[model samples]
Target: MYLTPSMAKLVHEFNKLPGIGPKTAQRLAFHILKISATEARVLASAIIEVKDRITNCPICYNITEDSPCSICKDTTRDHGLICVVEQPSDIIAMEKTRVYKGDYHVLQGAISPLDGIRPDNLRINELLMRIQQEKVKEIIIATDSDVEGEATALYLERLLRTMVARVSRIAHGIPIGSNIEYTDEVTLSKALESRRIL
Candidate 1:
């Protein structure tokens, strides 16, 4: 039987999300259909609220309700050393380890020339500006161990060589081609502790 218009539409929308296949999308759409109208409304409202209320932290480029973000505002965090990651999710993962006391800078994306993403496309310039303006002493590149991430970190290392701040790369305890978010807490903590100078 042909699917109804609304069901088809919902499935299409769900399919647009990352890693959600057509089968999973259909399952979710049907699941939503079975839920109470109030619950569905709550889910929809939650999604809308995030879009309307949450924003990128201007200082670190992480997602937050505030422009500066909690990490940037926290007095206890080390302002002299900054951990640089490719995305906001990576920052969240690192924070979960609770071993990192330094502030962070989300590069927003990695350099992938094959995909047309370049240094100019990322927040690299913003990082450089922050290092200079804040007199940052060290930068730990915690980007993913994938090819694109490696390329991005190398590019940053080269650009930061002449700068006063010491540049370092996060340890390779994380599997090659794996993102930080997937790494375990112990591994992440060790990576932070064993970070090597570039």
Candidate 2:
């Protein structure tokens, strides 16, 4: 199967993206080819614009167009309460809930010995610095319920126990509307352990 130089280049670029298989890359390349030149240019420009404008917030390490990010800047939000997460995407998920009214601290990544990620690699020191500087009353570990997320949360809890007034982990369990029969063993156990009295 021979592809033109330009088409091959496009396919290669698309394949570089995570979870994009060769067939999907080829499909994307063909879709790009089918689109008008103006639309293609717009797509290219949007990518370039994001690369040029987007950057991490210095305080919380969340991806943003500004340095501090809007969340860090907002005085109306509860700066005393900090919800710490492993990635910027997790912050988006939390925001979608719309019930939380506090600040966030993105650790950039979780500790995973298999992946060579350690405490030094994450923003742990920065979090400690924020605790010392800011009048934070509570620290909520909002990492994923996976092994790496648990490890990172435990490490943070141990480090922050004496420093902050309260340290807690976000409850992990089967999601709302999910069937018990469909849920995994660990999820069911966690749900049972975290159960509350109505």
Q: Which candidate number maximizes lDDT?
A: 2
Give lDDT: candidate 1, residue 158.
93
Give the alpha-carbon lDDT of every model.
0.90, 0.95
Summing lDDT over every window of 10 consecutive residues in candidate 2, give the lowest-scoring window: 169-178
Q: Which stretches of candidate 1 lie over 4 Å from their true place?
A: 174-198
Cα RMSD, model 2 = 1.0
lDDT of 1 by residue, 1-198 (tens): 478998999999999999999999999999999999999999999999999998888889999998789999999989998999998989879999999999999898999988889899998889888987997888999989888998888998998978945899876677779999999998898788887789
lDDT of 1: 0.90
Per-candidate TM vs. native? 0.86, 0.96
lDDT of 2 by residue, 115-147 (tens): 999999999999999999999999999998788
